[model samples]
Structure formats: structure tokens, C-alpha cells
Target: MPEIMSDTPTDFKHFIRIIGRGQRAGRTLTMQEAEQAMSMVINGQATAEQKGAFLMLLRVREETAEELAGFSQAFRTCSLASVADLSVDLDMGCYAGKRRHLPWFLLAVMLLAKNGKRIFLHGTHEPDSKRLYLKEVLPQIGFKVAQHPEQVQVALDTFGFAYMDLKQINPQLDDIIQLREQFGLRSCANTLARMLNPSHAAHCLQGIFHRKIDEKHRETAALLNDANVLCFRGEGGEVEFNPLRDVTLHVSRNGQQSSEDVTATCETFITKPQELDAKQLISVWTGEFDDIYANHAVVGTLSLMLVLVDKLDWTEAYQQAEQMWQGRDKKWPVVLPEDKSEVVPFDTTGKHYAH
Candidate 1:
């Protein structure tokens, strides 16, 4: 029963038969039928078997928070980047891809670019059979990878940190990375590829693994009024570091949202990474095990980037995360990677799935 276009359906097989008949009758679609079934899969007009039956019916009865804020407002109106200047942009990483570890948000964007803070970062690379990306661990940690989009705005205006990549800033959303490996799972293009912010950062710091996509990332940062967002539930979802607790952060300020339990203050600051499961964190991130789980995932990603730039509030962000784990060996080449086998160690036994 497809044909329902004009009277407000807008194709994509009439919004995938009204979200595959509300997931074949189990129901839950109205946020105007999940924003016309994500504006018919972001305007391509569905059809890869109706986008693999609306991504296996929104991955089996999940999605809400107004149907993930109507699929992040039909994916920020088919974004391609233009959400700049959210007060000196602060976008963070891990929109999935880096199964085990070593991607301490590329050393917390190189300590937020040696503390002047501009940072952008995007993904894609190490695709066909993944592992090792931040575009190959941020050029082994010195940070190049721009290659266009005006060298990612001249490396975010002179090395405050840039990166970009997603097949050079968006090759038709990186040609749907082979329909995300032909739906072997993950779609809505991996939550609209972490809401492709393009430095439209009104202070964002994403990292998802699921908690029902943190209400579609707080309704896509309150329909892009995005003044300060922070969605969490990280680790194997990539954005690692929570040695036995304090990871699940989720916030969304200025847009006003909330969440809690950061693993009892991130397990009271580090210490348990020498082969802690998941195929020994992918054999210590591929060097075949033991750089002390990439130095406790760069001191738990610089104490979760000083608790996302509040510069030490959550109990002084755990006493400056215990002086960043005793000056982590003079911040070891600023969080390793300059090709030390792309700092691996992460397979904490996968499968957390939700969004």
C-alpha cells in the first residue's frame, strides 16, 4: 500500500510505506511518521528494498524522542556543512569505527589543540574491514588529513586542529559507505553520521553506542539551535576510556538536556588496561598487544577532555584526572599514534547496539 505521496508523504516509497506500516503493526512512528520516514531516507527516495525495511524497522522497536527528533530533522535538511561558529566551534569524535581502543579522540584533539581550542574532526577511512581511523590515527598523531574543503578551513584556521576526511568532506555522504555494508546493520546513515556538524559546534562532544540514541541526540541538538550538546554512552562505541566506570555522560546544555552516572567519577581516575578483554582490546590495538592499552586510552582521553571543557568541575574533573595520570609520561608524544601501528587495543567484547 505505497502510493501516498502528495497529500503530505513526499515519496521515498511514500515514506517507506509509512515506516513499513509502523514496523509491521507493532507501531510507533508518528512524529509526523518520523519526519516522513526521515524525509524518505534523506531525500534519495528510499528503495534499496525501502532502505532495508526502514533499517530493520528502526532496529527493532527503538527510536523515540519524537522519533529521534524526526530523524534529526530529516538529517539537518540534507546537510553538507554550514553550522559554523557555535562560539569557537568544538566538535569531538567517534561516530563509530574503531571497535576496540586507541582513539582517545585523537588525544582529545591534541589536548584541544594545545589549548587554544578550535578542533573539527570527521571520519571515514580504514573502511573495507575497519580498525585504525581518525583518518589513520590523525596522520599518526601530527594531524594532517585535510586534503580539501579548503584544507578543512586551513586546518581550522592554522592548526587549532581540523581533519575532515569523510571521503573529502562529503562525497554524497561518502557514497553511503556501500549502504553501510549493505545493512549488515547501522543506518539512518549511522545516525546521520553523527549529525555532521562541520564546526557548527555550539560546543558539541558526541559519542554514541546507544541509550536509545540519547533521544536522537537531544532532538538533534534541539533542532540545531545547538548551544552546547554532549551525548554519551561510549567506549566500544568508540571515544573510549572508562576503566571499570564513569563513562556514560550525556548532556545537551544551552539546548538543555541531561543524563548522568559517569562510572563513579570515571572509576576514580584510571588503571586497568593491560589486556582487558575483547580479544585483548584487539591485541593491544594491533601491535599485537601491550602498550598498556594505549596508555590507558590516553589517560582516559585527558580525563574526558577535562569533563568536556568545564576545565575540571566533576570533583575537579577527578582532581585534574589525577594530574592526567601522573603527567602521562610527558603526554607521551601527545597521546601516541604517529604510526605506532595506529594505537589499537579496544575489543571489549563488542555488541552494545541501540540506535
Candidate 2:
């Protein structure tokens, strides 16, 4: 009979050797190995030092699609709740909170919701900055943040959309992400989080800061067996498509490869944070504010989502998106009535801001 091999590693050190064997001597982990290793980290079986070393070593070489798929599967196993029965149309990730630009994509999502799409948005605002995280901006714009899975369902049932933070979805991974301050660099957690798709929506969109990571996102989604995923380099790394620059979108549908470049349609000179107004999100949505850049950004973003959902062809989608933006109701529930009875804790800069 032929010999059969088992997946048992001698120890954590043996697993570490697969990836940390030194610069030229190192090798990437097999998909199964990556999954087992990450599960150990998530399940609290790995030492703190081992976890740090594992993440840092992956960072040094950058992660591969198989590696990302394994990590993401492990994460999903640990954190994902059953929204599988819900009528979710999109899974949006906003992990890279806006820094260089206000979240124009937020308006795009609202536009989609208004058009009757059930969307779920999730993210974590790293304590490093107060620069317009979605957790803060959502409330300001009249959207509630769900701190629990049941609450996520409630928000979705009540509103067309809901936002969940990483800490709420998976505290262990959130703790790993916060390790940024300690490691002085991002680990694969950020990448995996973007691809998590907690609701297991049929379609997903990812925004990345670096142009180089575009392919990484597409390939990882493919490895995860996601039928439809669109990843592009957004303005400031949030999933909102940038209107100011030409962008090449990497797309994966049913493990097939396809890509296209979106030529810049608007040439605006506003790039700095001081030049942009956060309130414009509401202004534009309400049809009171008019800026060419904002208009194109919102429409362009909506057009992509529309295409992802197979609602329209790219060109037709753009035109229809413009129509939807022009005809958007000014009264789709911005802020709910407040009650002082219930107190909620807001996390800002690692300090508690309760109301």
C-alpha cells in the first residue's frame, strides 16, 4: 500500500519553521497548515510571542492567496454569526477608516440602500486617529452602529443597512489588529478582515490603499471560493471608488479572472483632509449640496455596486446611478429619536466616550 501522511506538526516551533526559516531559507505555509496555525492563534493555543512572530514573518514576505484564504477561513470559523438566512445584498468592509478623504462611499451605500439593497457594513476604527472613522460618522449621518450580532440583525431589519465594528464581530482579531502599535506594521489581519464577509453575502467589494495589493485581494477572494468580489484601490483605502484617479479594478466571479481600468471621469484638485467637509455626505445625499467631484464619486461608486449585483451593465449602471442619485428621497431616516435613558459607550483613542 502507498504511504499516507498526517497533518500533525511536532510543535508550534515546527509550524513556525515552515515560514520563519530565515530570508532565503523560509517557505510559505501550505493552505491546511496556514489554517491550523491561525486557528491556534485565534483559539488561544499559541503564545503571544509566537503569534507576533507568525504575523510579522508573514508581513515580511507579504501574504499569498492560499495563506490569506486559510487565515480568513480560520477567522470565519471563530467569529462569523448566522446572517446566512438574511436577505443581504452586499458585504462592505471599511477597515481603513478615511484619512485623506471623507467617506464619500458612505453616501454610495446609502444610495444603494435607498434603491432597496440590503447591505451590511463592518469595520474597526483603530484608536490611532479620530479622522472620521465610520463608527463616528455613521451616527453623525443618522445610522446606528450595532455592537452585537443580534443587534446587527435588528439594525438590518429596521434600517436597510447596518454597521458592525470588528471588536463586536471578533474581539480576538480586534486585539490582533490593535497590535499595530506594538509591531509598527500591519499584519495579515487587516487583509483577512476585509475579506471576511460575515454575512456571506453573494457579492463583496474591497478598497485598498496600495495599488499593488489589488491583485492580492482578487486572488484571495478566489481562493476563498467567493463567486463575486470586486477589489480596487480606493481614495484612502476605504472601499469607495476614487473619482479623481484612473483605477484598475480586479474582479473575481466564480474563480474566474477579469480586470478593467476605470478612466478618471472627474479631475478635482481636492486631496487634503482640511479641504473636504464631512457634512457634505448628508448635504449631497439630501440633494442640497452640489459638487462635481462628490457627484461623480457617489455615482461612480454606486455604479460599481450595481454592476456587482448584476442590476445593469457598466455604462447603463453609471447612467442609472446618476438617476438614482438625482431622485433620492430626502427622507430615508437619518437620525432616530433619542432617549437619555440608555447609555452607550463610544470608543475614541482607546478612551471611553459614553453618552
Candidate 3:
């Protein structure tokens, strides 16, 4: 890193020094210190150079659960909290876009919303992302972006779901996130963004691109005392699963953390995934397309969520999800409404819970 200019603000300068002391002398920040460091960035007390240096240093050394917890806590301290009072059932953090396939998990969310689950989905779709973003597909499926923070409540009340970009929720973090452009790599911002529960929703779901970070996420949820959470290595870093690949899900329930190693289903369940297309999600939902992989992705994601929310076993959850899929509002979401809906945790061990 360039020498800290003599004019560097003391507010965040020490933090950079602490973490950038080279591998041997540098150590992880305590949750409190991490929180303090993040607070400076969020509150504009940190300079751009300091922000990049701090984040990239953590990225190189990797982030701990405590740091993730601290970062999220700090960010939320200044976040736009218009919907904090809502009784949201699920908090969905979907920042990673998909490159391998359509985000079928979205259809699962739509199904839950249709069935009266108040869900809040928050993330971003950068202009430079190479992968497909759900924001693009949301319009085709009758979802609206809450333009302002207040519109979030209306969308949830009227449609049972809502979405807001990070800029709308907390521009500071979004701005920090964009620093990836300058740094040429992602920082802890992406992970902590997923860790935010925003509304203290009853349940939360997190997906990470790296398997190693899965435990950090689960531990962070435990640290925050997240009521319930599911964390796993998701498809292309999304909250959707790769049915053909075994996934170990780290779940935290009522403050207790556990891991469930889910076995991969038959290779035939979802095979030969079609070329990426957002319309495929809508088509599959409308019964106009038959892609086994997409179908399994939807049902499996929905079933897993059912297990979390209703506490049902896997078999029953799958049955329930299949039924929900077969019984979804086939012709609903017929047209986009004129009014704007606003647009748009935890770690555990390797243990198996009997389904």
C-alpha cells in the first residue's frame, strides 16, 4: 500500500496499520474493533484509499466470523431502516448474480410470497456484472423495484415481497462495494452485505461463492443471535443449489447452529441445463417449458425454505414444494402495476439431522 500521507485522518488510519502489518504481525480485528473500523467507513470518516486498503487487506488475510459480524453491525447502524418495523418472514440477500443458469430460486420466492410469506429481497445489479441479475428478470415476473425506502412497506403489504438495491438501503456500503472496480477483487463488503438482517426478520438465507467462508457466515449469524438462518455454498454464489452437486448447509435455529450435509439427488433430476435466459424462469413457472434442472432448482430451494419456516422434514417439504409448484397462481402477476413497488447468517458443524 502507498505510504499513508501525513494528512491521513486518524479516525481510520490506525485500523489500516493494524491489519496491514504483514502476515506475522497483522492479526484479525476483534468484533468491536472491526465494528469501529467499519463505522468510520460508513460515516464518511475514512478516506477512499483507507477503505480500499482496509478491505483488500482483509480480503488477502480472509475475514473472520467476528469481523463479518462487526462489519454488518456497523453498516446497519446507519442503514435506511424504513422497513425495520415490518413483520417480515424472510430476509433474502442476493448480491451474487448467476453465470451458469437462470436464478430459479426466484420462482421459489414468488411462490412463498404468493402463499403469504412477507419476504424482503435486497441486492444489487451492477452495470458491469457479466452474470445475469434477478432485477432484470423481476419485471418479466411482475415484480417492482421500490424506488424509495418507504415504498418497501407498500410492496410487501400489497405483493408479499419487495426489493431494494444496496444504494437505496445504504449507499456507503454500495460505494465501498463498487471499489471492487478499483481493487480488481471483491472485499468483505460482499459477505457482510449478505449478513445484514436489516429488519430482524424471522428467518434469513445466505449464499456464498467460496466454501471456506460458509462457516464464517454461520458463526456470524450465531454471533448476532440470528433467530434462524441457512448458509451454504450456492450456485454461482447465489442462494440457489446445484441439485446435481452435494451441498452442506449450515443452519442456525433459535441461536443453535448445526450443519446438514445434503446428498445429491439422482443425476437425472436436473440435467442438461439450457443456455442462460431469464425468460426460462418465467416459462418454467408458467408450465410452458420443461427443464428438469430448473424444476429441481425451484422445488428444492422452495422445499428447503419450507423446512426452515414450517420446520417440516425434507420429504414432506419436497412434497409441499412440489404441490406449491403445481398449484401456483398460474395466471397471476398478469401485468405490471403502474405504481412503484419499491424495487427491490450462521455457522454450524458437520452433523446430519434426519429428514
Cα RMSDs, all models? 18.1, 5.2, 7.4
Worst 10 residues of 1 by lDDT: 274-283
Q: What does candidate 3's lDDT look like per residue over 1-355, in tens digits?
A: 1122234466587888888898899788888888877877765678777877888888888888888888888887767767677779999888887766778888888899999898888888654456566776677566777777578888888878888788788787788777766776777878878888776789998888776678878888898888899888888788887788888888888668888778765488443343555556667877888878887888888877887788777778888999998888776565745745433201112221110
**Candidate 3, residue 95: lDDT:** 89
Q: Could you give candidate 2's per-residue lDDT for residues 1-355 as a string of tens digits? A: 1111333333566667878887788888877778878877776667788888888988888888888888887888756565555679899888887655568888888878877888999888665544457887776556778877687778777777889888877777888888987876778888888898888899998888876798988988888779789999987778887788888878888898688777887876854434445456777767676767778888989988987887466788888888988887876465644644442323223322110
- Kindly list the per-residue Cα lDDT of model 1 for residues 147-240, writing each as its tens digit: 7666777766675777666655555455564465666555555555666665566566777766566556766676555677766666656655
Question: What TM-score goes with each of the models?
Answer: 0.32, 0.88, 0.88
Give the lDDT of residue 173 in candidate 3.
76
- Show how many residue pairs clash in every candidate, following the order shown: 13, 1, 12
Which should have the higher TM-score, number 1 or number 3?
A: 3
Give the alpha-carbon lDDT of every model.
0.57, 0.76, 0.77
| Order of the predicted models by lDDT, top scorer first | 3, 2, 1
